[model samples]
Target: MKKIVSLLLTATMVLGLAACGNTDEETPETPETPGEEETLTGTGEGYGGEVTVTVTMDGDTITNVVAEGPDETDGVGTPALEQLPEKFVEANSADVDVIAGATVTSRGLIYAMKNALDPDANPWPMVEEEEDPSNVEASDVALGFGISSLGRKGPGADDTETQVWSINEVLASALFDGEGKIIYLNVDQVEVATPNYDGEGMPHLSGWPGQGGYNIDEDHDEKVDGVTEDTEENFIAEVELWKTKRERGDDYKMGISTWSEQMDAYEETFVGMTVEEIEEWFEKYTSDRNGRPLKEGSEDAEDKAKYDALSAEDKEMLADVTTSATMSLNDSHGNIIEAIRKAYENRMGLEITEAEAAGFGVSFMPRIGPGKDDQDVQVYSLNQVFANTLFDEEGRVVAIHVDQLEVASPNYDGAGMPHFSGFPGQGGYNYDEDHDEKVDGKTEDTEENFFSEIESWMTKRERGDDYKMGISTWAEQMDGYEEVFIGKTVEEIEEWFDKYTSDRNGRALKDGSEDAEDKAKYDALSDEEKAMLADVTASATMSLNDAHGDIIKAIRASFENREVINLSVN
Candidate 1:
């Protein structure tokens, strides 16, 4: 994205009126000695344009410098014209000083100083590069592979742009604010061929339905008419794909059905096979249809020859597959899961956990085509994802998908479907790991309900974050266990629990305080339970620290928005 500059100026006028009044007063004031005007001029150029200035003052500080030129880069030289004092502003000028990278602009400013008095007072140019000892120190140490692998390596300035644009479309909402949408479409088709019959004829692939074996293209009218005679094996398979487009607002969500069986077959069929075998199978499969084979030799040879004619580049290109499939996944349910993952990533400030990654459900497509004839096979996968959210003062995801997930699920099942297997016209196995009852007979609904319970507690107590409520709930539960839960030394808490459970016959802790063990637990209640806990006691403290870290991150973001250098024209 190109950087753009815009300038806005606001000025206010005030008028005051006073009723007629007459007063007689006599006062005399003597004129003091006129102070000498110490004149100082500075010219500096910054990231954008240049400005020059001359200040007339009586002290070490110039106190004021006016600038005129093309718009200066915000947060840069503009500070010189604002709140900065005279000494620093002069130091930032070209004749007196240059604002580093804006040297030319700084010179331009100095040249513009003709408007000021005392041309002979023009200061000779002195460009002194400020020594950044930090950089020098950094260079002194060898940042070898060990350090680089730790992600401590420095990146070029353009790397930030790349990160922004890697998933630019998704970030569009956050960056561009819903000016455009990113969509992903997927389509799948099979590149199938029959196996060649060796001297020892191989068993025809007819054991499974939907599997390519002993099958014929009944639609082949010429072959049906018996006009072609040939004998060959055939290989048949199904291809899945998808397509994504940026359209409408960002809230658009699309999905499709995927049959992993086809994928499984693909893995078994072509993934590990040599190119020779693939071609042979294509020939034999295309030749033999039903019980009859098409024209032999030259036709098959023509096909093989055509394939051979492809340049190495063509072969390399052909090996790739790209396509898309898109369907309205859930009209209003466009929260493409990317945001959830991002929230987790930002929250944790680390690579995602495997559980979180698995829940993300993002993948790629293998091949794509309009149908089968104009098949363009290219591997497609989800790149960077983005979302735009409309919040009301307080930040919260209201309308999701303000700019949905845009991925290129080419030539694969872009549709979010798991493997399906069951008796034909009957129930089949659902391979959806996310389906209800995924965890210990618990479904998404169960988790939702659990969170809902927590939410109820929050609403009742007016707590703002789930972590707060979760921690409170855990603290309450721990109340009936045996320790002064408040600031109890870690050892004390452990000891208390051990003593409380010493004679409990190793029974799991129950939810009431009817027994002696329960009373001991209740007596250990803390006034303020771990209000930031996410799991159990030990984990709760860690969670509180994590929440604090999140708060610190937000603070840092706020700090970054503030100007690094304070400038005033005084």
Candidate 2:
């Protein structure tokens, strides 16, 4: 199969409210330092014209705030000018609620007041009260990954929009509150073939990264990684660098806000909601066909019906949701709500704090190199893996999960899957090692046989003792690595990999290569490094990157993808 893996959500850290903090520094151009009482006047742009404010400060207290804008709209800007001054005087700060129908006027008045108070600040920013997570994992918390498809849209007949098939991967991650509610949620999606999807709307990806032809690279020839053909290798090479919606941040623009910002808005709305509640909310608020919130004044019959059906209170609620997010939550764009449901199903409890963080990632690879070298008897295997993590406020990995599923041709199953030649399913034949033949029970390869084994797609953990690693099962060793990673940060894990794993293959240092250089590197390890290396061998001996999978990459991304959550341990 091709590399049609689902997308992943990552975050760019957000700025806090330090901009709203009180400052003792005198205004940059204040004429003189006022001792007990001082009056300062400032002006700002309103909906119709300039709005002005004069602040009267008595010592540290705001004694009065007066705002005026003569050309402003009578009913809209007038009420804001008359009412917001008193609000500012009572609050003593420009950060407050925006007047419902007089947003521009209220904002202008607030900006003028802020200017009168400091003379050196931008008009008050439209800031929301966001609780960014400093921590994410608590004992009761769980991190999950949910993926869905947008199906596929045509390289359509429409000329107005670009003609291309879009193969989509919508992904969601959530921090579960352990009380059946989601504490934090992150969502993102990727459309693989924006301009060049196959006729069937399946993926026709090459090593090209963008709509503009392929990028030249040192490793890749011709175009992407230098390959001359559109093969699995070419696809893998291309997708490794692809960015999801959240990962693209500001570059992936939507309407007024970036994709990440809008997704953040949707994510915040999901907090404290159960999976069922979220589904109901999506169905009730969003359009039945497109999954977009109804516009208040839309003349379309369906939209008007939805708009009219909403109670006055629900209308306000819908307005609050649409202000920051208007992207379709499901339908052709992406089935985000379905992903959330999957996340709840996949949830695994961990001990973490709401102030901490959690993240999810997957690494995929297709291996078909020469191991048991035979021209016709070559092996092909595909590995897709996951290693999500939980972190404390200071970024220590508190919980780590490592699991994988390896599917391969019957001739070549790695340590994770044992290969028995000549079989439709279970094998009872013994192999003649010297003669290179099978003896006893006979089996043949056929379409029926191949189709029959479809149910044989088993996970490493599901394989249990069948997945032999000589010293232990694959699951046991992976578990041991998880133990090694506990309490370690991403940095520490990287350092550990550098010290103990072989640089060439990413396997445990000496197992894959014990050459002179490898021996020298191993011998030069400090005592602590050597001890840690020796200890880890008891559990695992697999590469985190080489032919196996990108476990390290997944872990690092999990850290980079951390976001604030509302989990509670107690």
**Could you list the CA RMSD of all candidates, in the order they appear?**
29.1, 16.9
- Model 1 has an lDDT value of 0.26
Residues 1-570, model 2: lDDT tens digits: 111221111111112234446578753552655557888887776767688988888766788887889988778568888899889888978887766556667767877877777775553433345765443334566767666644344434223333333445566677676677886777767665432332222223332211123222233121233322435456455445555666665445554345676777888788888999999988888888678887688767898898898899999988887766777888666678887997788677765433466676656665663343233334445555656677777788887876665655444424335332222222322222332322322234332443333324445655778777657887788878888888888999999888777777787765335487678788887878777777888677877777767788878877887754434576
Query: Per-residue CA lDDT of candidate 1, range 441-502, in tens?
Result: 21122223322221121111111122233435323322222122333332443444443332
Q: What are the Cα lDDT values of the candidates?
A: 0.26, 0.63
TM-score of 1: 0.19
- Alpha-carbon deviation at 103 in model 1, angstroms: 20
Model 1, backbone clash pairs (residues 3+ apart or across chains), number: 84
- State TM-scores per candidate: 0.19, 0.60
